[model samples]
Target: MEKQGVEVVVAHHERATLRAGNMFLKIDTDQARAEIEIDAMERAPIPTPEILWRRPPVLALAALSGTALGRLGEPSTASSAAWAAVGAAVRRLHDAPLPPRPGSGIDELATELDTECEWLAANGVLSTDVITRNRRIAEAALRPWTPVFTHGDLQVAHVFIDGDEITGVLDWSEAAQGDALYDLATLTLGHPEHLGDVLTGYGTAADLDVIRAWWSLRSLRGARWLVEHGFEPNSPGCEIDILRTQALRA
Candidate 1:
């Protein structure tokens, strides 16, 4: 446990820590936290229980290297309503006025992508060319889309529900400003049956091509990461298979 003021944050699991205060903490690298804080201050309202302590790079790597996949059944009508509420909340979040753009342009994305590809190569995962190519495809798809504050890691687990209402959204460590449709696409592709209600709740239909491409990119990224982390022979192999299937369908 670590302390910042009266807050007592506990690292119970690998990827996340609990701040015994009004907020939650994600155990990511210093660099990742910096990026997330900048993103929040610019785009979304800064979430509470912010960064209080840092873990070593080795621990951080162990914490956030893979995606969690489960055969989530369709949410009940109550859950459906909760999703809609969350969608509305996201719309308001995106609608919030943002600050001036930073001097560091989106060019940083290329660096991050290159780093991911290089890491994959170091791990003997796959040819770097594939990563490069897919990134190009993703970039091309995002070109015509307007940018907005995006919850880069939106997933079912991050959504909090209270009866038929979405009480909260969590995990902003990967949040940033990007094409709003990219966020929607990630949600839709990850949970297709809920797409209709989510879209209706958000009151905007995403461009099909953009959504497909983003979904494809997300799938490839997950697969590549799984391979890189030596998870090919492990239970996570199922995740690779599922993501591959999603990508192929796209």
Candidate 2:
């Protein structure tokens, strides 16, 4: 599709559809998402498409409809291994020195968490206790850890692979500079019972435990988001139960 001298591909993978041209445009309504991507690009993150346009409500609606399909369960070993490779790559990315937070202190993550909690509550999907617990866990984890470039939504889909090698880690809309472990946690939480291969590929047994706890905390946040975004409560389509179970073990 051609529009205003731009060729729109409408490339729909698992997340936002891409509209391509001189730059790239993402149409996800999640403001935190847009900020994450733009910020990562500004900070010289790993390779990712550039965003030049946005249709937030449209994207949000599409995501919600897809989540209702009950197709969120299941795991793929190939994909899991690929995700582990992506995690290793992200670790290398974070190894590089980074600039200070652009306009806010690193502590501003608390503000972002508050905003996410408020939005989830407004949507009638998350409990205050869940949000509060997540906040406390996050603050504690980040306390001693130094901030680094992080993929705010690292998961299987965001990671592209060819056989055992990772081709690219896509989707930067959720990337930020914080505890790098937070990114890994996002991935493991999304696939808790299914992360055996990934953990093995990424670290030792001790590191695995650390990774799980980090992911558990981040997964709680993702659970609230999934519910707020219209995934049915206690339904098989939702992974909050999976996350909660993992957190309990952690």
Candidate 3:
């Protein structure tokens, strides 16, 4: 085998992904999470990266053959049909048999949301009015809902598409039984322009207000963690922009 140069895909304290030729090596400090990710990939109905092998803390997977649907802080070049295809794939995943592991409950999410909001305020990350209004909007997501098999973290970047078809999805560590709407909300976060296209393929009516509320909730909760992880949640078209946009709409 010819030696290929390794490229750093993503790096943080918890985990790092390295790419060499057509193989991806995911190294995680937490082996339990890696085990869960492997199980989730095996159980998921939709396309996922092919697991080449696994060795304790490092998991090797064959790279998929498509570009990511989009980045968080950049405009998506994928067509509406591509986005719609991703939505359809997500619907299939949601309709699959529930995973054995349960996701975060509403109570847990509420507590985290409150904690994050307080931190954001105390750190002077955003204006009080923005945080307050966004927090109010975020409350709509705390209601009860039927749980389904969910991706849990279906960010657009995790979805891969070639033309108008979905190739595969990545990052399965968060997969579990949870609210289906949370998956939809996560997919379209920071990319509101594709909501209608996704809903068209979802083949069901969804509460837009609740989805918006999740946008607020997720942004509020993720901002601090992102900062701690050396990521910029305040970048253009990211979490902070999403929160500020909610304020402008009010």
The top-ranked prediction according to lDDT is 3
lDDT of each: 0.52, 0.52, 0.92
Candidate 2 ranges beyond 4 A from true positions:
1-25, 28-47, 50-72, 79-81, 99-142, 193-210, 232-238, 247-250
Residues 1-250 of candidate 3 have per-residue lDDT tens digits of: 8778999999998899999999999999898888888889998989999999999789999998989999999999999999988888988998889888898988999999989999999999999999999999999999999989998899998899998999999999988999888899999999999999999888889999999999999999999989889999889999998999998886
Candidate 3 clashing pairs, residues 3+ apart or interchain: none
Q: What's the TM for model 3?
A: 0.97
In model 3, the runs with Cα more than 4 Å from the true position are: 1-3
Query: Per-residue lDDT for 68 in model 3?
Result: 96
Using TM-score as the measure, the top candidate is 3
Error of 1 at 167 (Å): 1.4
Error of 1 at 107 (Å): 7.2
The parts of candidate 1 lying over 4 Å away from their true place are: 1-25, 28-35, 38-78, 99-140, 226-239, 247-250
Per-model TM values vs. the true structure: 0.61, 0.59, 0.97
Cα lDDT tens digits for candidate 2, 62-99: 11101110023544456555556655676666775664
Output the TM-score of candidate 1.
0.61
Report the poorest 10 consecutive residues by lDDT, candidate 1: 58-67
